[model samples]
Target: MFCYQCEQTAKGEGCKTMGVCGKKPEVAALQDLLIYALQGLALVAVEGRKAGVTDEEANLFTCEAVFSTLTNVDFDPERFVALIKRTVALRDSLAQKVKAAGGKTDFSEAAFTFQPAADLNGLVKQGEEVDLKNASDDNADIQSLKHILLFGIKGVAAYADHAKILGQEDDQVYAFIQESLVNLLRKDMGLQDWVGLVLKCGETNLRAMELLDAGNTGTYGHPVPTEVPLGAKAGKAILVSGHDLKDLEMLLKQTEGKGINIYTHGEMLPAHGYPELKKYSHFYGHYGTAWQNQQKEFAEFPGAILMTTNCIQKPQQSYQGNIFTTGLVGWPAVAHVDDKGCPSLLDKVKSAVGLGCSSQGKDFSAVIKKAQELPGFAADTDKGKVMVGFARNTVMGVADKVIQAVKDKNIRHFFLVAGCDGAKPGRNYYTEFVEKVPSDCVVLTLACGKFRFFDQNLGDIGGIPRLLDVGQCNDAYSAIQIAVALSQAFECGVNDLPLSMVLSWYEQKAVAILLTLLHLGIKDIRLGPSLPAFVTPNVLNVLVENFDIKPISTPDEDLKTILG
Candidate 1:
């Protein structure tokens, strides 16, 4: 298993023995084979689209399957094996549609003709043959570009899947994904063309993110500023982690008035800002910081834990039974709440929180019951609160004041210090950088990386908070919009604005978001804790030459460079 799709591959190179994220060799092989199967499925889907046949179910499944393979999402080999079989079934189904439409169905690419093994052992063997390091490309630079595109597409699929759950659908995004999957096998493109396609992955990701923002803000109502407690309310409690809003809402609804308090964990911390989710009286406050610390955090938590989507670390034995996974996030022997036909765990109590029911069928009753059975917080604890929901809507609502403050020199500069978090070293740079951000400059943060300085008392300039908590990483669209709006107000390009992006990436979503930034022609951005292991030096050089992207250095040095 030679996989290096994330920032923390083994020793900053491909993971040969196993994944740095605790994935076993068998799971890794299955994931690789799953990708191989998805490629075939995508090839057939692309052909179907050319024949004017687009299956909505196929599009949604493709997105979900691609997203599940992302780092730390699903570590269940059984799940991957099932997904591989589904991919072949779907691929063959789509191929038949293409043939019926008088289109050519046969292809030379092995992915188009690949077959899955009958069992898990056989499947893992098949997967080992098509692992990422064994891609057909021998050119290091081209392979790097292909990896960038593939990983970026995974991120895009994540956002697309989220948006689809919220009743938002974009056919062109689906088309780009399917076509790009097949294009990975293309021999016609030059290295520069591959570079263009990689950037286009970023371009397509912008649309996927836009749809997610719309689905979130449009359904849940634009997030307004809300202060969420870091302390726990003594009672039955359910801690919801990961980034799925619908799961959080469903749990909130089912647990309502049952004496269960729903607390946000990790990326779900942003849920408090949304009006629809926050209105639940039982919806409580945040628990832990980010995904990497979950083993420690989940163990200490006094109630049931639900991981929704990605960044799920292996559950500590102390709290494994107390943890439940929903959506595509999975772990071996972990209780899952994904049965669509599963009965509603609680009686349907009326609530106004109708923010799209695309993901409503799952029964969170088991989680609620576990919460009821467990002894919740022994007593009330007050860790105070942090301000959130300063997304595009709220920030733009104060556009006049912010523009004036910038003009009046009260606001020195802007730093968008955001990205995913990991347990690796050097992450303290984000904490230190935010701490060292000059008082006059505002720091805008989104994603779990905001955990570094989220609770810091940075005060405010005039009425605006010095540190703005943009939504989750899913809301990168909001951050981009905020930058564009500020640039438009100042009548300059985004790069010309006083804003600088210093991001820390840990996974594919961050990769996709970075690609979006690059596609927009934004320059002079600093990215760290470390560059992706998959990005060869030549590929890095292209990024540096084309976009002035660079790695992060010391806080003082970076501050001096940006501020001076």
Candidate 2:
């Protein structure tokens, strides 16, 4: 499919035969089709805006369609085909409505269609399917810019979709997603326009992140520092992966006192920091590292694995029967959780109960008893000397301090190092980058990507640690808020400030954040472990010339480049 949009792309190049994430040819083709369908849907919504469409429906569609295309979000061809059909129907219906009103409508031009790999000659001889390679775009740079916008929109769609699922929805974020996608369909779009829209994607995503932060912090409490145990107690256990707090909360509630111990996996590890979630005695600790390790991690664990979102990998048959997927995450054989987030997991947990060896004998009463003794810390509960509200508000409060820090050289430069994590080896560049940051500099990070360096003991500059993890990747919103606050405090534009963004992208969400940075006129940002394959040379030119977006190199070299 020529998909190199993720860190795990084969050989650091495009995944031609199959996705390194274990996505098959048909699945990848369907995903592309689904994305195209969503683009069409975005076009409809954009036109609907002129016809006075309510922002809610338009936004909802934007979020869902985008969510469907995220890495590992949907692998089930059945589910994907259904979504494509739904999107096509939505576009068609909207077009009809517009037609009746005598309004003109346009859709994104279709790039390519899917066919069996065996139908192709050379690639077929190599056992690979020829997929959509964006061949229709005659201009290399415009293709790259289009890819940046397209990928960014996909990323925003993911975060907004998750927020919507939590019973929290924002109309503005959705509208921006629709508006952003539709704007890219124009053939004559300028580089400046693309760059501006990219930054706006970041800004809107920041708002989406803020909305989710509020939804999460308001629903749960602000995340606090909490130590979670690694292994599970003696009982039936269910490991929940991906990044959906509401799903975790509901699962914790349903499985609570039912003798099912719930463990957090992958990005869900941070959920333990949230107040409302950790209150459940049955909630266990984190399982493994990033989502890439899932196939092996899930093998040894004894319980049901519930995938609530992205970063899904092809599963081994050993645990295949026990895995359950909900929301946008899907796989061929895994049982699908229905709309209510209910899957037949409990029965599987029950059946596997007496089959596997227990962490202890019988019940986990002792572990649960021990957990209650530990106290939790969050925004409302931190009570620590270090300030926690460094989001937009706290940043404003300390605006003078940040400006003063820069003035006094206590903070040499500000670096926004953020994005998702994957199986790529060079991703260690992030660990080294954090380690190599000058003592006078402050490092701001977000997303599961930050886990690479978050645990490091980077001592404080004054009272603030040199490396400050703002929160999850979606909390890049918090990072942006802090940046804007600093810029205002310094009485300069954000791009003019002595701040540099060195981002490590693994998924589409990073795409949106990069776009947002560009939209805000932020420049000289470094992005790596690798540039996206979807980006054409022309697109790269647009980014390089306008935003100064560059690939990462040695931490020493990059540090010198940014500092010197």
Which pairs, if any, clash in model 1? none
In angstroms, give how far residue 497 of model 1 lies from its true place. 0.6
What is the C-alpha local distance difference test score of each model? Answer: 0.87, 0.68
Model 1 TM-score is 0.96
Give the Å shift of residue 221 in candidate 2: 3.2
Say which candidate scores most in TM-score. Answer: 1
Give candidate 1's error at residue 410 in angstroms: 0.6
* Residue 450 lDDT, candidate 2, scale 0-100: 70
lDDT of 1 at 501: 95
Worst 10 residues of 2 by lDDT: 352-361
TM-score of model 2 vs. true structure: 0.79
